[model samples]
Target: MNEAPNRNRPAREVIAGDRRYVWHPFTQHGTEGEPTVIARAKAATLFDADGTEILDLVSSWWTCTHGHAHPKLNAALAKQAAEFEHVMFAGFTHAPAVDLAERLVRLLPGDLSRVFFSDDGSTSVEVALKIAYQYWINRGEPRRTLLLAFDGGYHGDTLGAMSVGRGSQMFKPFRDLMCQVLVLPYPATFEGDDAVEEREAGALSAFQALLAERGQSIAAMIIEPLLQGAGGMRVCRPSFLKRLVETAQAFGVIVIFDEVMTGFGRTGTLFALEQADVVPDLVCLSKGLTAGYMPMAVTVAREAIFEAFLGESFDRALPHGHSFTANPLACAVACASLDLFEEEKTLERIQAINLRHRELLAELQRRSDVTRPRVLGSIVAFDVKDIGAYQSDESRKLKAWYLAHGLNIRPLGSTLYLMPPYCITDEEMSRAYAGLIEGLDSLKR
Candidate 1:
């Protein structure tokens, strides 16, 4: 079990030793061990120690929006490191943090102005949940204890996030410790799905009934905006989201959009809320927030919501603060990443990916092994026939097959999805889609 960490060690050796010490997220280590060790990464490609170029079709877990180690972001991180790495965000403020917050507020919809910082997606979600929960409590409504979330919604793994994401089924072990979050059916639709209206009506009716019953006690309702990423990339209609927002607002429920996986031009727009025309009371952002250069998360809320916590008493203030909150290095990289969105024309590239996704989705439907074909922005996904479920033997075999083909495509249950970086070339994307077709064909009879 003594694997050397140098340029000479084999990739397999490093990978094998990783099993002995490292524990991966969302993985059962008892059965799944020796995870692949990526030595280096560039735009749309990861290189193992042995130098196998693995195509990153999932954007490195849906974070690297502009691509891996983007030059601008790298430079930003280096510059910030020389100046200041991190400082306690409680009483101190930095240029990168303040500038990034201002930039983000300008880009987001409506007057969502107050930005609270954290370290990752889960904490961002936790911040939003806590803020909303306490906002009502501070306003003399401590009884508003209930939270609302969609059936397939996934926020994060923290306790507060876990409560809202109870429907995701990834928290079975800690189920007893988690709080209650009311689940409403997610009315998902894909290309050429004509029954969407009926499904939306059913969902709306369910939500209306829930609001009619427990709407007063509800603190907030957190959503994935347009596409629910971890919940099998389930996509909801924009009109349905608008109606839901209106209904929640009418009932005085704080609407929160968990844009952790959908923010920063991943959905062919700056944010998914741009397409829906609905402003949320709070928005959770992370993942691509720093364009994969650093880990940072933000919970942006409306001014009035922030005002609710503005009393001289410490009890009225939100009791959340991370040591690396508003980290200068992360903020600097995020600002650079934002620049790439303009200078590099990232939106145009994403639009091209959207076109390619549509074309590939149509071709994917022609295959006999794919089912439930769906496309949202640059993301295209379908269920493979043989892969039964997330923890099934067949699922592991399918994932291994993709790895053997030098593609890092992390599947969700039987669902095979692609969310390549915005910098992915047409040739690379074509190769990935072709690999998916081949993987599907291999699983066939």
Candidate 2:
């Protein structure tokens, strides 16, 4: 039986199908409101069914670096598809994959020269963890099996990724299944904070104490770098990061940076590491790798780490790989996106966004209802006066308020944030900030 085709379906019709068969992530269907059916999107603006416009202030969950449906990205995909769609990446090599890898190696900081392509952010982190763990085994130090992570850092959802991010309290149900990991204190700083130095010192001390205790046993230390994304936009100073890395490497621990959310010009630079002036032994990058056009991530390793895996026996090689590893289409689009970084002058755009965020923060400082105002590159975040942790009732109110005003902003508990696509205009940023001020004032009244 031939049913109605999907191409020209209405909003209600699409949502009806979704309710019957689709299971969304991090959502509750019984009590939650119906999901907005986004029919079309472009340049930081999303239109639902009936073409109602909504400004995407959260960059559609902090992706879409260049914006939605950028014509250059679309053209790149179409051109690649005409040649070929996908090819299994084992033993075989393609121009797109090789070229993208080469470009990433040159672009990334430090000696991260080897790239292992994966399907998404979670798997990219998983690859980095696995490589770090096995790197010790291949080098005859299996005793160094423990992983290190930062408290309040959320990496991804996979078992290994969840293990490192367990301190974020997002993976409580899977605690029994995940392997052991050492979590250090994260010194979360904000604007007009007087005790930031004390917090930084205490956190550094905690890292030192932990490293001293497990110095020889830790396989690797993975951090979210300068800005911890899923941790309520908790930002740390770059000097803190530099000192932290120096301390970890001194303990003979391999360092890994999970740049899943902060990479590709999110943090006022081409990469967040560039700001910290630090280079990790391993780094996982995704999200904006293809300007959010496709799901692709890479675990880049130092040349020395890659060399350690070379051996005659298959036992010494890294056995981990995804089925869609180095898909030709993703690689081609990623290359195109990287080119747009220069063509569109994305870093300059981000600087302008940062300047605007600073101006907004100045306005936010006058309000008693707002607290912990912080800005990093294209991201700006602040907390409401008296809301609880992640998944609080008050945060839901904040979210509904934004939605009512035709904005897409999903807050982390009390912390409302904006990570607008770089293509968003100055006027749009001002509107988003003004709406936020109005929302907070309404709550206060």
Candidate 3:
């Protein structure tokens, strides 16, 4: 995009166009001011139109796995585009889609063998919801209709996704329109929290109580497993997750793990499910699926769940799909991203990142201003004590301070966190943590 005038337009003109035309997500343009016009990015750094360099500590919203503009990913995308860009996946198939699905199936834990493609994370969750619901219908249990979700869990922005994620408190406007979802407590824990076990025990009791009342009527219970991304990067214990999944399954409730943000070495492993050693009936994957090179997602269903949808009539068919389902370009890049994991020992990189996070978070937590400091794989998060809502004066000040310090951090209300990509270097990590301390110091002032 550096060749033409339109491609490399001045930041002022781009900002003017954005202000006039583009309605951005999670932004109040009038007060939030001009968005940075990033011209390009590499590894863990972003280059804006004004030539300012910023470290992408949030992996560009937790998608850039290996890095931005990776060579292997670029090659895969370009090669696939020249061969076969896209084809309808309903009636036909291609190597990239099949290959990617196989790779993911092998990488994923348990008997997750069926891959249903979608455009993004939300659509992937929607697919899982429809499939999980219709699975009972096809099995002659149409009465099993109510969906379940954990408190402080977020799936996506779609209607069905929002229904399950309603407890996140970001879907107030659409509450009346969303389907009824049974909410359970999430034992959101942190480092040095001695009371987590008590909360987990209470959560288990509450979950049992809910299931006892409506277990048979519930179709599926969706959770974010170890890491809940949009719900403030809140983390829970793996032992607790394993127990939750087992309890759900014992009650015949289909469990869905929403690993859209935690998959592909984000949680110090290939998948978060590995740490829990529990398999769900359905799992939603995206964000890092194509390593931030393209928008792609898949809801991998257990063979049993998939078999329920297999019948003679189209009525039993999963009546959901995006126009670009299993887009060849995306599949190709995803396949390449998976390859990079083995070739570059990405999981090991995630381990080093995790260790670095613990070291920095320990130092950060010493400050009186920070609390509930936690680290999960490459992600580190903590709350700014005595802060208010998502759009408060404290939030604005923190955002501005981070931006001024060349750190691309978007704090979740009072919760501040980092989810840098696996390719983030030592220098970038130091700078990001330094910025974190400086921002907290400014808060003290």
Model 3 poorest 10 in a row by lDDT: 1-10
lDDT of 3 by residue, 329-370 (tens): 999999999889989999989899999998997798778888
Candidate 1's C-alpha lDDT?
0.88
Give the higher-lDDT candidate: 1 or 3.
Answer: 3
- State the lDDT of candidate 1 residue by residue for 143-210, as single tens digits: 99889998878888889898889888878888888888889999988777889999999999999999
Off by over 4 Å in 1: 1-13
Highest lDDT among the candidates is held by which one?
Answer: 2
Candidate that beats the other on lDDT, 1 or 2, i.e. the better one: 2
TM-score of 1: 0.97
Please estimate how well model 2 matches the true structure, expressed as its whole-model Cα lDDT.
Answer: 0.90
Q: How does residue 79 of candidate 1 score in lDDT? A: 91
Tens-place lDDT per residue, model 2, 1-445, is 2222325987788889999999999998886888888877889988777677789999877779999999999999999999999988888989999999999999987789999999899999999999999999999999999998989999999999999999889987898999999888899999888999999999999989887887889999999889999989999999999999999888889999999999999999888998889889999998999888889999999999999999899999999888899988899999999999999999999999999999999988887878999999999999887767877877787788888888888879888899999999988887898888777766666
